[model samples]
Target: MTDETSARIAPPLTDLPIAVSERGFYSGFSKHVTIPSKIIISLLIVWAIAFPVNAGEVLGIANTTIIRLFSGWYVWLVGGFLVLSIILAALPASGKLRLGRAGDVPEFSRFSWFAMMFGAGLGIGMLTYSTGEPLSHLQNNPVIIAGEATALTENAVRSAYVYSFLHWGFSAWAIYALVGLAIGYVAYRRGLPLTIRSGLAPLLGHRLSGMSGHAVDIVAVVATILGISVTLGLGVEQFVQGLNRIGMGDWLLAKDNSASIPAIVLALMIIVGASTLSALSGVGKGIKWLSNLNLVLSFILFAAFLIAGSALFSLEIFARGLLDYVTALPALSFITNAPDGTTIGDGIAQWQLDWTVFYWAWWIAFAPFVGMFIARVSKGRTVREYILGVVIAPALMCFVWLSLVGGTAVELVLSGAGEGNIVGTVLSDQLYATIAALMDSGLAYAFSVLVVLLLLTYVITSADSAILVVNTINAGGNDSDHGRRHIMFWGVAIALVVGSLLLVGGLDAIRTAMIIGALPFSFVSALLAVAVVKAIWRDTIRLRHGIECTVPPEAKADPAS
Candidate 1:
């Protein structure tokens, strides 16, 4: 556990040359950019362009079909395995394992670390789903529908929050945790490249340098771009809704219009521009500052709602809903359908496909980008600490936020205190309209301003980190290649993907693309879980055996060997 051994634990750094002479617009092709990644990125650009131009034939049928076909049990197993991985890692034997060298101190403070992980892990998801998802489940949940409950009863409310937690809670974060742990341990402990391929070194060994490694990085880049773009698109949609809610839609768009091309362009330009600058500023300065600002803005918004809205009612729902979520975890985790008696509509199959299945796909798609970012900032922490920060803390915060925001909306609708149909409004305008309905004029205006600020910061945090993660993967895991031009390229790429898809099929097209992208990476995630466990086992053996460390011949191979 000395510095020498810790240093030895890091795999020898490989020299993957970047072709400087091949420069073009936005840090052109590098020699280090593997062929598989290059080809995948090229085809993706063409496909995205075609999706918009031939939306009728290309996106309407093909992409939707791909989403429907693969977004079933494939994603469910992905979710289940991820949750199991995180739970296992937190156990006594493995939980003590450090992400980096033994006794290494974390680079960022507890506050900064938590803030960054929370911002990167959830991004605009909280902004979009905090209100809409909870309300949607309350109204249309399979459990309630099967029982023939037309009204929002006490039981319906409990089930609604439980489902919301299921989507955003432990299962979602587990995907990120598994990836982060794998990459972090390999990069910090085993001295491997901090890329997706490196996460599999224990499992794949020297094959990591062959086509196998290239394929893994390619998948990571593709999934990161598509996954982050889906979030960017949703953030833009919600930002537009907030603008409209605050009476600024006319200024940003035409009269009574939402999701117009001009508005979408404006939002993307702002997001990509800010994110590029943040990426250039590096993780310590730009990402750190924005993350802190985002956390503060979030607190302001949450507190405003809690005070202005019914505090007691929201608190009661959150307290009770949290317990309900915990109590229902075992059944809910495995609940794919209703029992035989409920001769209801489609029962659990359809419900699983729509909500849980789609969410699993989205989280899987996001795992690489968020997981890498989490790994980058989490050096020197125990596996247990990482799990608590990455999984438990944020999930609980989401539950509370959902309770206060979406819970209040449901209460308002059920009590007939709100004007428009809350459920219908949630589907369209999401949190903005919900905030508008829940608060008075002054509070509503304040909430709207906070929403815009929070949205901007969260998207920037996501975009900047995604840009860095993509660059790291493309550069074969050398994070020091912080060329401004490279960061700008990825930043613009994210904007284009989201902007074009937003124009074509709107959010649905973007969602479909994300699910399709996640399908392949879901298998990659399963491999990573296996890799992490294997790596931990070897590390434990090494710790016990000291200088004459013992591992299998394959596990002991040096990079040059």
Candidate 2:
């Protein structure tokens, strides 16, 4: 086909606002917005008063029941769709699928970049699951998959890695990749505002520039806040629990339910201040620096776990678990907990439902923000580079972390060589229990403390970035710099919501809250199917036909009608 013919096949820009706002845009779609310091700090106070959320009851009976309805078949379909997309993304010829400014190479070193990306994206999960999660799974693997009432002796280690990898692998990455692709293409090529709604521009056309689009932006903003704040709350709780474990069980400052309103307020202050400062420093220096620190500390934790914990068992578990993960990946990727699901016990099926469904919900809920963040950071990069870096690189790093930390825990417990009950007490104190049980060295304890601190850094990194993303959705294109004062407002808002839920119920409460919050958004994700396909079809046609046309002047930013 002639260039004109080829271009004609591409779709026109959807509802992109004209002349992308350059002053505030970071990476690609993220913008620098401000939330106030006092407002930010006050979240801890609300959380302190909340003093333990009643998450299970708070989400109510019906919402919990709704989340439970997500069937294995649903995951099966989602996983399959995700795999198909990856295959397309991985094809050798995918190099031709350029987005904007053809041949935009990565500016940062590969190692530093990938490490930061992985650290920010997966930090909370890694820390949360490292100690207790493995041991619990080891004691009893997923009964449904094993065809038994309890875990198979050999399957415990394998299943943990299996589930970990499944959660972090292709499906999660696809959400990021597609969303990033949408935003990057629109913002970089079409020069739209760096907002989540911009990704939908190609589909919505000029209409997205109007009040109709405002609704979409609002939903995206709320979802982004809820998703990231929940994760941050979890991180703060982990920190408190870790401190307790380390024998520094002071005034319950770190404890969620146990913590006073003052304590919760303190934690919120710390997270928001760090987040606001980081936001000021700009994405490249602030986020990149903290992310680098996070990566280094994560590596240190892995090394400590490998060398000081149970070297032989860790290595053995790493190798064997990897093999089993590969073997069972397909089956485990889509396994569900609906009855006929398994014949375990009374609460067993419920546990499985809560666990698996909750994970899917979390990943799905955060997908939009994470995807938007990845796209923003990935400007001047190619499709191949983006896919490989965003998907492949992170998955491997997650596998390594699981193998080292949780894997070693399994080896210790199964071999009858360590205090197996230590993992059981993680809810009370994760950091100290991990350090005390794994190694007897002062150096090891020091290292563990450092890792804990580093974990804190990452929580800041992710939370701050999340705050920015959420604000971008809120302010729309009319404003990118709603100023630091404006941004801090949401940061504090997040802290209150998360802290209150935690005090009312803890992880269980958050889990229930997240599921409830996530239910409506699941339908939104389904809408993505129609949106992306329409976008692709239209954009592909415009590209093939080589149409270079001007979007209407004022309508460009308010094109929804």
Candidate 3:
């Protein structure tokens, strides 16, 4: 059908540029998208296959060239934007603007809202990094490396948790919050397609319906896929580590190593299989239930650490780390640490390339999915509430989690309670091994079992939500019930991509892919920040002029073309 013809019959439930295809693999799949989006997806699929197939050459070149070049700038840009998000939230006028209509209240309860956001935002990353990151940092962070006398001194340990908080704190979530606020305000308040392109609509207006808009959506889609796949691959590796430590050790070790490609494949099969089922079961049922269960299990595991370990010490670490995180924010936010041979600046520069740059890229890559998902669930909240919930709540949770689990583990290792090299295991990406080392046989087995459960649930929450988000973008931003075929396609596609990258070069390959995907979206995120500011400024002016800024129902979508 022609564009105008389709518009005439198109349902108001969707703002898709074309009618929903009735004869496709999915019910709500878009029959029309800008040609540029199609070309971009095709190119990305080819790139995914080619780079992995020639990993040695392609990855080396990309890492030394594209990835390395952007790493330095990403740290500053991402940190600056995050600080900007806080300022925007602090503005008296902007804080009061609601995301939805004036009378609309939150759809989910407070607990459910936080649970879903937390589960989706951090997921298995928290499980993998909580203990591992602090231990890794304790052994060698910028502060400690700059001539600290003892590796496990209080100064070193405190610095460890501070970096942890910086990585997982307001800065990370602020990326997601900016994108979410932009998309939610433009899409809901302005009655536009609920897609990444719509986030730029305020800046571009109807021009967002052109090739420029297509490029934005395409970049978002590719970034979301790579970002989720990186997480999926990480989750799979940790899950395998936990499983092998529990019972499958000899079998996996007999193949190639504990983290053999075969082992990773087997892990993916199980995780992707369960995640696909959850995606098919739809959001309200499978995803919600699994997220809630993840939260409960996570609580139990974290509480066990807090109770069994140095509770007083952990609390002290948390309080002190929180202070350090705040005090150090200015330096931490924008310090690029340019190299100048054998100096603290040079060392910090390398560290930024390795950790801070990598994390900022990963978070930006993740922002499109997490941001969109947050926007979806955060329909009726005010800008301030949404920003605080996204930025503050999750960061606080991470501080407590890192301090308790990481603090306890660091104490054990430094005090010489454990024989295992926690730093070595973590650096080798076998963090579950460290977790096992920290507990007794019975407790270790229990911890492994709980971790596996949490892993599966967190992966499912992430994958299912990503499937929905990608399909939403694919179908031109209509988030109606997509066909099972489309959902399952993305599930399997993610599995294959993660598996392919793992086989080629493992985590390095995955990390490079994420960085590349994020490079483009970084520009998109900057535009989103600008669009949000413009939108809020306009809303502020309307309110000051005694005008109701909310769109009336009849104006949300037209019945006649």
Query: What is the Cα-based TM-score of model 2?
Result: 0.83
Superposed model 3: Cα runs more than 4 Å off: 1-23, 31-53, 253-258, 426-431, 553-561
lDDT of 3 by residue, 393-471 (tens): 9989988988887777777777776565565563423345556667778987888888888888998899988888888
Top lDDT model: 3
Candidate 1 residue-wise lDDT, 173-233, digit = tens: 8888888888887777656667887888777777777667777877888898889988898
Q: Write the per-residue lDDT of candidate 2 for residues 350-426, one digit (tens) a residue.
A: 66665666667777667667877776677667667777778777777666666677666666566654565555565
Best by TM-score: 3
Q: What is the C-alpha lDDT of each candidate?
A: 0.76, 0.61, 0.78
- When sorted by lDDT, best at the front, the candidate numbers are 3, 1, 2
Instruction: Show where candidate 1 strays beyond 4 Å.
Output: 1-39, 48-56, 60-72, 151-154, 251-257, 338-347, 426-428, 547-561
Badly placed stretches (over 4 Å) of model 2 are: 1-11, 18-58, 72-77, 92-95, 144-155, 245-247, 253-262, 335-337, 345-352, 477-482, 533-561
List TM-scores for all candidates, in order. 0.89, 0.83, 0.91
